[model samples]
Target: MGKWSNQINGRGNWSFTKYIYDNLYNFQWINRENNEIEDNLILTKSISLERVEQYIYFKDIFKGEYFSKLLEIPEALEELKIHMPEGYKTKEDIIDVINSRALNPNLKALDMSLPTHLNFVLISLNLPPHEGEVNDPMEYIVDALEKKYTKEENN
Candidate 1:
C-alpha cells in the first residue's frame, strides 16, 4: 500500500473538511521515486489579511453549501481586524475573537448535516433589522451555478 493510501485510510479521526484543510497546508512535491508527497512540516507563517485577499479571489471555486457564508466571514474578519483593539495579529486570533461574541445555546433539534449548517448561517445573515427579508443562500448558489454552467449549453 502506498503512503498516501495509508494516510487516507487512517483518516477516521478527521472530518472531511478538516482533512482537506490540513492537507492544503502542505507543500506537495514529487519524491525521488515519482511519488507525490508533502513535506511533513507545519508552517508557522500566519495567514494575514494580505493572504486573505488572495484567498478570497479563488474562494468562489470552493463552493459547497457553506461557500457564501465562508466568503462573508473573511470580509467580516477583515473589518474586525481593523476595529480590533491591540493584541490580535493573526487571522486565527481574529476568528477566536469573533467567536467570543456573546450568544445563547439556543440550538434546536434537527438534521446537523453540513448542508443544513450552511443553510442556517445563510438564513441568519440575510435576516433583517426591519428591512430586507431573508433569502436562502443555497438557492442563490444553485441559481448562480445554473446560470454559469447552463449558459454554455444553451449557446
Candidate 2:
C-alpha cells in the first residue's frame, strides 16, 4: 500500500527486509514496556548497539554470563549480505532496504527481540552517512520504528 509495499511487490521473497520490519516493531514494543515499568523495579534495560558490542566483547574476554543467545553480530552481518538485493554496493541501497522495511505495514508486529536484531544489523554493518551522502539508514530505522510504535499505540 506504501512505497515499501510497492518495492516488496517488485521483488518477491525479501526475507531480510521482512525480518528488519518485524524486528523494528518488536523493539518499539519493548521500549514502550520498559517505559511503563517502575524505574527501580527494572532489572535490565534496552541498550544501544555499542553497549551490546561491549557486552559481547566483555563476555568473550571474561567468559561470564551470556546475556542473549539471539543472532550474534557476525551472523547478523553475514545474513545482511546474504539477503541484500543483488548488485547493491552503495550505502543508499542499504538505506532503501531499511526505509522500505520500515514503511511496510504487513510485516509490522511486536516481537520484543527486535532491538537484538537491530543491534546485530547496526553493529555488523556501517550505517553512518559520509559527507555528501543523502540517506542515513540508521536514522530511517529509528524513525520507522517510532512511527510504527506510534501507530500501534494509537490503535
The TM-score of candidate 1 is 0.20
Once fitted onto the true fold, the runs of candidate 1 whose alpha carbons sit more than 4 angstroms away are 1-77, 80-86, 89-112, 127-155
lDDT tens per residue, model 2, 11-55: 232111123333321111112322321111111224222211111
What's the true lDDT of residue 146 in model 1? 74
Minimum summed lDDT over a 10-residue window in model 2 is located at 50-59
Can you give the lDDT of residue 146 in candidate 2? 79
TM-score of each: 0.20, 0.20
Give the clashing pairs for model 2. none
